[model samples]
Target: MPKEDQNNLLFTLQHDFKTKLFLSYIDIKFKAVLINSSTSWYKLASYTIEEKNSVLSKIHLHLDDFVTIYEEDHEKSYAIIKGIF
Candidate 1:
């Protein structure tokens, strides 16, 4: 996606969730952590395979998609890619 589009997506992600995720697992385990507005980190581990696939498709979040990284808690973090719609 274009840089402008990517920025818009990132902005939406931040606005919706306030804080970004830290140390999310995009591997086979499909585990992820999300930080809330209060700065508390929580795990997102209950997503079923079918639900995950559906959300992934809706957001167009591909493995190869260029993501903006944030360095938090001394680890590389990323915004949970979600669609505005």
Candidate 2:
């Protein structure tokens, strides 16, 4: 295989791993919120908007409720935001 092909493969794998890791992290965090057993939510959202928007965009923001949203192409829901943390 050519060097360029190898670089492309590496980039693809890195992107996949990052997406998976992120989904997993958010899943755990959502469960914690539903169970109302974590302060991490508050700590987690304290970051600046620029630093947080990408990951945050995957979910809906609520002051008194939990909300999970997704792109139109994403049929499955990641999290359901109902109860407050």
Candidate 3:
């Protein structure tokens, strides 16, 4: 590749990465699953908006409630909800 081509490729890569990083941090939606002790369990009948602590405020939790939160399009659940803040 020529010098101009290399510079263009670098710029494109950098721009793509920056856009992805910014989108990942902004307006992210999350899903919080409630863990039950028995074999039967289900998702909550509510929406969780991660912006401005809305998800944390709307959901009521108990000491025994084993809640696991997963980011949109992610398979792994976060260990703790407070870590999101």
Best by TM-score, which number? 2
- Candidate 3 per-residue C-alpha lDDT over 1-85 given as tens digits, one digit per residue, 9 for 90 to 100: 9999998996786666556545665646434433332232233334545767554535554334557777678865744222110
Clashing pairs in 2: 66-81, 67-81
lDDT per residue for candidate 1 within 13-47, as digits (tens), equals 66655422343333335566444544333332223
TM-score, structure 3 vs. true: 0.32
The parts of candidate 1 lying over 4 Å away from their true place are 19-85
lDDT of 2: 0.52
Better of 2 and 3 by TM-score: 2
Q: 29 in model 2: Cα distance from truth in Å?
A: 0.9
Ranking by TM-score: 2, 3, 1
Residue 2's lDDT in candidate 3: 100
* Candidate 3: 10-residue stretch with minimal lDDT: 35-44
Tens-digit per-residue lDDT, 17-64, candidate 2: 556656887976865422222222231232334344464423335544
Which candidate ranks first by lDDT, i.e. highest?
A: 2
- Candidate 2 residue spans exceeding 4 A from truth: 30-85
The lDDT, on a scale of 0 to 1, for candidate 3 is: 0.51
